[model samples]
Target: MPTPNQAALDFLLNRRSRPAKTLTTPVPNRAELETILTAAARTPDHGKLEPWRFIVLEKPALNRLAALVDQRGNDLGIDPDKITKANAQFATADLVVAVISAPVDSPKVPQIEQVYSAGAVCLALVNAGLAAGWGANWLSGWASHDRAFVTEGLGLAEHEHVAGFIHLGTEKNAPPERPRPDLAAITTWVDA
Candidate 1:
């Protein structure tokens, strides 16, 4: 017989991500954020290749990013509505952790595996923030995928990419539970 951790299971089952727009000020401070980040860094990293890094973006940095989003959107001739939404993502954010997927060169570990690790880190970060009593949401927009924007704004290397931008703050509103996938429909029992 195995002892089950009910608290952990309960949290996992009931956890909900607050929308980025619904997040507000009073985010975690440096020391508090360090604890949350430490939890996030404990994710699985096969081959010991830490294929991810975190960049904490404060209000000033976010403002800069918001401006850059506008510039990049204009330069790329993106839809005006898209630019406004993307700009608001950064402009209104008080705190965000930019998960950078920096895949290491390893013959044993495939690049795809490294990318997956980075994505896992993003999820871990969001979960960590939520566990720490902060509203958290994982976000990625057109600016995150734009090479020029990442290069100029975030100073990402050629091999690095934006895994996700985790917004963290106080929750303004509690969103109603949305529909969840049916596990039975997606499950496959392969007994070969």
Candidate 2:
């Protein structure tokens, strides 16, 4: 059997995401955040295309994003309830890293793999924060999918899209564990 890291395996088994609302101030500082980002960047890239990037949002920028979300939601005729929910997240955000999926031109590396890499980066960022004793959650809502919001609020390019918005902060309270999936039901075994 290959040598295993018990602590790492234990963390993986018990890892739970803290809800965004429960996340408070005291996010990762510059050097510390850089460590997390570095961990996140260690995702798989088939062709070294590195088809992803991170945009860290502070309080002021988050406030501006909230306003932009409000405006865009109204302009796009989204329901008031949905608009309110979307705007609220930005308004209350302490700090977030916007995971952007920017697929590059690659003859062998497929676009789908690039997208998956971006997603892995998001998950890695979340786990890094959690392991460092901070609350972290990955969230993406209607705002992420809105082209106008992505361009105007976040300044993302035409080829870029938000894979996830990873919010990191101090934990307000330890949340109870929710229901988990039944592994047997979701698993498939085949020996061909």
Question: What's the TM-score of each model vs. the native?
Answer: 0.99, 0.98
RMSD of each predicted structure: 0.6, 0.7
Instruction: Report the lDDT tens digits of candidate 2 across residue range 1-192.
Output: 999999999999999999998988888899999999998898888888999999999999999999998999999999999999988788998999999999999989989999999999999999999998899999999999999999998999999999999999998999999999999999999999
lDDT per residue for candidate 1 within 13-40, as digits (tens), equals 9999999999999999999999999999
After the best TM-score superposition of candidate 1, give how far the Cα of residue 41 lies from its true spot, in angstroms: 0.5
Single out the weakest 10-residue window by summed lDDT for candidate 1: 2-11
Superposed Cα RMSD, model 2: 0.7
Predicted structure with the largest lDDT when compared to the true one: 1
